[model samples]
Target: MSNEVKSIGIIGLGSMGMGAAKSCINAGLDVYGIDLNEAALATLSDAGAKAVSTNALDFSQQLDAVLVLVVNAKQVNTVLFKTGLAASLKPKTVVMVSATISADDAKQIEQQLNSYDLIMLDAPVSGGAAKAATGDMTIMASGSAEAFSKLKPVLDATAAKVYNIGEQIGLGATVKIIHQLLAGVHIAVGAEAMALAARANIPLDLMYDVVTNAAGNSWMFENRMKHVVDGDYSPKSMVDIFVKDLNLVADTAKDLQFPLQLSSTALNMFISASNAGHGQEDDSAVIKVFDGITLPGVEK
Candidate 1:
């Protein structure tokens, strides 16, 4: 690998995927974006990206690196394996996997990619959509040296912090899973706090201000509280995302014989929120679990 990534391919154009594709374009790298959604494809094109309809349809085998930001294992396989993209990709063209996948799934995909002689980088991410759009996301990466070399431009363009966790493909996913545990717990706790404050007839604005400034604050607390305060359920990160992530955390812990009581509890809360038809809503709407409690300054 030359360590000089110029032309890149981005698969998926959802919120995070679009942000990442824009970040690459902002870094002066040529980006070929692929998505099934016509609106997302047009958005990428409008933003100066070369929008390709799909991974299988994109005629850019000259790509130095490919970034997979699709939903999960199934989508990853659909793009790389089903579309014959893995075989069609030029040798040493690094494949950066940014999806939130299980360790087993990561390992499986790594091996599958290796079969085509393509380098696989298990590079899951943090810092959400805003950070991604600003080219300031945190990447938890673990892969071969060659893979990293080919992915230099991607890391440069999309991540403010890239922790090269190890050489194993699944290590990054493991770390991301751990981080998701804390994130899910904090969001659940934040919802619980707002619910309690509302139930006690405490002024939610005052309570939110106090808790956010005090040691009780968290990133999720500050971010999600604003949604609760605004009664804006627009999904920055949807409730089902936590339902998927936290479930992964719980399953991983169980397999490792590690007891994570807090994560388990939070995972259940997310499940309940999802079951209550908040699955597609912003995760902050987990606060809706509290019956008959209205936020003072926000509409229901």
Candidate 2:
């Protein structure tokens, strides 16, 4: 069955997308790296994946599955619909979308793809780039059993844990957005707490050690604070990505007339960080927004 899924394509070649492409190669699948960036294509090619310049690709590759890990729903839509890729795919092809999107949007995408006789899988991933590279990422996924069966090899090639949420097209997206709700808020709180420590003239490393050992510890605090300790906000995941993701969560809640207090607050912090020209910086740099908060890298 793995050999049956000989050709696979990745739409975006950013950190997460690139990692997944490498994971596909590691699984011994024929992986096609698609991106507008020559450098990203080169990097994937260096890792033994076939590099295709999106502008000039041979249509004969006949991919069995294509993973869309682009930044947002807008980019996902552009890649599938506007680029004419979805319509060009043959029937029984599985088009898995891994972008963090609203359930409504995910359902809409599935319906559109169905018109082209393509299977749409709503599969959102977690565990960041490093885990993705090693194919150890968690996937919150929902799709028809037929779609799941046809795309089994593609699923195993990139995920360590693939949660079968439901047969519905958008069920996975619903869970993924809820995850963003917690992730965005947790990172924001970590930034605020660490910023307060800096304002109080506390040693950054010392405070990190204490909190990580004590009850104040959180996964976000432990993971994101390492960037602060090293003074490198080099965009592992950019502030603007969280700005967009949190806003998606807020909008999804708004439509249901549900209140999201912490997620709403965190969205503002990310927005402020973006508006202050830290948008492209790593999300941990959100601490830079607080007045008199010393960011080790920004000054140095």
Candidate 3:
């Protein structure tokens, strides 16, 4: 671990990626943000990040680390192997795997990257786009001390809390699963509660305030109720995002002989909403699944 991490590169410039790029710039690191979307590049460039047009930036020789903040395992693989960026990386460059992936997948990826002699961090993030943009997200991470040493700047730039859960690459991902369980169930419960209140003729705004301040308060309640209040479904994080994450929960639990009935049920609810074509909408639209309530200004 070097005392100084002069520069780092980031792949993907979606909501989360943009936040991470901004965090890196705020940390005084020379940050190169890569994305296929020119508009995304322009935004990052305007924010003081160096924008690269392709996924093919070779950070191995010059970069201290490269953070992959893409949506899923497939995107991570694409940014690394398919795009030919991994091979071009300098030896021992910290590969910060920030996507939420299965523990098995994380281990396999770590093992594969080790063949290239790269330092790998099984790091998954939380705190959403706002947090990422503010450099205040939480990182659930596990990896070699060497990897942490190399990636400290990026981690410092992006995380307000970095939980080094364990050394095994899979543990960090497993913790992320536990987080998804609480997160998924909370969102589903919040949606159902709001819909139930609306169906029972209680004002949606009143219900939002009551539950948020009462014993039933949760992070999801705070996050999703704003959508119902504003009648906005534009995705800060989509329902389909939970659909994928909760499905990973089901699959991971089954493999571990763990029964997560509550999480499983919530996964189905999110899946149903996604199947009903609300996949791109904000996850708060899960309320739409409960039937018969007009959201004031919004249509179903």
Candidate 4:
């Protein structure tokens, strides 16, 4: 059978989803967008999406593939099951789940989708909003060969790199969780280092420049700390996001009887930042948890 997906429905028109939707349109695919935000729907409509609505059931029959890019497993379950998306989709339709969720949750979702005769890909994405906008994000995915064959066009449009982990339902989510461990730790430790520099009256910009060019620099430090230096905490990604992701890491590790000291510490840092009312702020605001230092563009 020829497995070709020329039409796709995307749930969640947030930063990542909106970008992927645009990329699909750019790739000349028929795109349907579903989101609660009317403005986002209008924007996608203007971007040449074939349709936009708050409910996928409105256009589910037109979709050859469904991309779920919501925040967590709960939202994914709600959209796919409670909201009637799964029941509405045509049998054998490929569903690519790109949320940051636990491996166990991914497995459960896959089993549920199988009952509907739908193909499930446990796909989690990285590279943030900017890269997503340019169709250069990375996707770690695991699914059956049929699902991979069916989703090829959408995958090519949305991701610059796609790692096929295997034919397992949860391995993609597992890889993404492991990646989040490093990402959360790097951001937390970068905040600590910057906080120490601030305490010593060193110029944060200068510190950023030196460190970014040095061996100690990480992708998280380079990207997130720039938000700190520019004093723009407008939440490219929120503090609570890492709190959730790291908590997943912690929970997964506990299940495996493994100890993740750095990940645990980073999770606490994010928790502290969230508890301090920075939950909605950019994750770089973790630096705000440090006392007695003046942050740029904020009244101390």
Best by lDDT: 4
lDDT of 3: 0.85
Clashes of each: 0, 0, 2, 0
Cα displacement (Å) at residue 86, model 4 = 0.8
Positional deviation of 111 in candidate 3, in angstroms? 1.3
What TM-score goes with each of the models?
A: 0.93, 0.92, 0.94, 0.96
For candidate 2, write residues 1-300 as lDDT tens digits: 342466788889988899888888888888888888999989988999765667413552468888899878888889888878887777778888999999889998998999988888899999988988888889999998877777777788888899999999888998999998888888999999988898899999999999999999889889998898789999888899899899889888987899888899999999999999999998998888898777676682
By TM-score, the best candidate is 4
Residues 121-194 of candidate 1 have per-residue lDDT tens digits of 99998887888899999999999887887788789899999999999988999999999999999999999988
The Cα local distance difference test for each model comes to 0.87, 0.86, 0.85, 0.94
Clashing pairs in 3: 60-89, 60-90
lDDT of candidate 2?
0.86
Cα deviation of 265 in candidate 3 (Å)?
0.8
lDDT, candidate 4, 34-141, per-residue tens: 999999999999999999999889989999999999999999999999998899899999999999999999999999999999999999999989988999999999
Q: Lowest summed-lDDT stretch of 10 residues in model 2?
A: 53-62
Name every residue pair that clashes in candidate 4.
none
The 10-residue segment of model 4 with minimum total lDDT is: 291-300
Query: Residue 33 lDDT in model 3?
Result: 79
